[model samples]
Target: MSQQTKSDYVDDVDVDDDWDDHPTDDELEATVENLEASGFDVEVVSDAEEALDVLVSEIPAGASVMNGHSTTLEEIGFDDYLGEGDHDWENLAADIWSIDDDAERDAARRAAQTADYFLGSVNGIAQDGTLVAADLSGSRVGAYPFAAQNLLLVAGVNKVVEDVEAARERLHEFAYAFENERAQEAYGVESYPSKELVYRQEGTEGRTTVVLVEETLGY
Candidate 1:
């Protein structure tokens, strides 16, 4: 995964008119520092492999792990890893999807909100250290505020924005569109942000960890 400049994603990053402008290395450094200062433990990795390694080693072997629909995770091979990789932790998503009954499957998905570890991605991250995410339902973001014991978010650097407002714009312009397209194809309906979560600051120490990768991943 190359550290593509903002120019590379000129057509895709629609956080706003100027939101597509990618930050420089200095801006990235500042963003990391700002993120850490705001109480989010941050990890700066160069590529998807490093990001996967971080997830594999940081999460305990037997700690129940779960994740939602994330293209970034898919791109990094995490979906397959959680399903097929040798590990001791329970993969809740697999469990939720395995149920033969639709009603039971929906229940399991809700139950997963309390998993030992909840993993997901964000729509955008602000330089001020705020995280912005949206979903058709609150199933994923619902765990971030209080449901999960520990939370891990894997995001590509392309998500970093200049400010909180830009973060929201990115979600509306880019993330929502990308997801709506996927939803229409997958479920025969368009998707919108039925539920939104803005992670302000984590009060607990070491409870929420964010892995920031340098490559262009996700919407």
Candidate 2:
């Protein structure tokens, strides 16, 4: 069977700028506080550097860390940051089921299973504190269930959509395109059809802790 391109599989989802009526910082703070009250550990940071500090401190020394293929992580220079830290960190970039190498592929799979902490982004998080995400490669989203002991979701304020429908739209409109671009750049393909897998799963990870950053972080 012939495979489809990303453009062929992804539905047209639009981002409504009207939804950009963001709350004030105080309101955002209160919302975050309420989420914490609901038993979800939440933190808000000003920028990527502070996020790195939080990441360093949250991940204990000697703990194994697994990372998703987060554009935000790459944008924030997490690869370099991980090198400077003393903890054991594994990059799951090659685990997306698209990589052709066997050993690197196996290592990525193992990293997803054995890591103490997993870090990535959410497609959308409701103002009421519900976390929403879509999975394409499955590895990035699949790892959430049994891959890591603790799941840390780092999302930008822009990712906060009004509802799940909006979240899905954002994924098709923004996240999917961004992710596809990265895939093309790395793999020399214009698109990958695996994106249809996104509709197969709900949220990833069992125990999830979300960190909402006010500024733009990841794609």
Tell me, by lDDT, which candidate is best: 1
Q: Model 1, 1-219: lDDT tens per residue?
A: 222223344454344444445678988999888888888999999999999999888889788888878878877778778988588899998888789999999888888989899998998999989999999888889888888989889988988998889898889977786687666656789788989888989988898999999988786
Q: After superposition, how far is residue 60 of candidate 2 from its true place, in Å?
A: 0.8
lDDT of 1 at 211: 96
User: On a 0 to 100 scale, what is the lDDT of residue 150 in model 1?
Assistant: 92
TM-score of each candidate structure, all chains considered together: 0.89, 0.72
Which portions of model 2 show Cα errors greater than 4 Å? 1-23, 30-34, 84-104, 107-111, 190-207
What is the C-alpha local distance difference test score of each model?
A: 0.83, 0.60
The reply for model 1, stretches above 4 Å from the true place, is 1-21
For candidate 2, the lDDT comes to: 0.60
lDDT of 2 by residue, 185-206 (tens): 5666654325331221224433
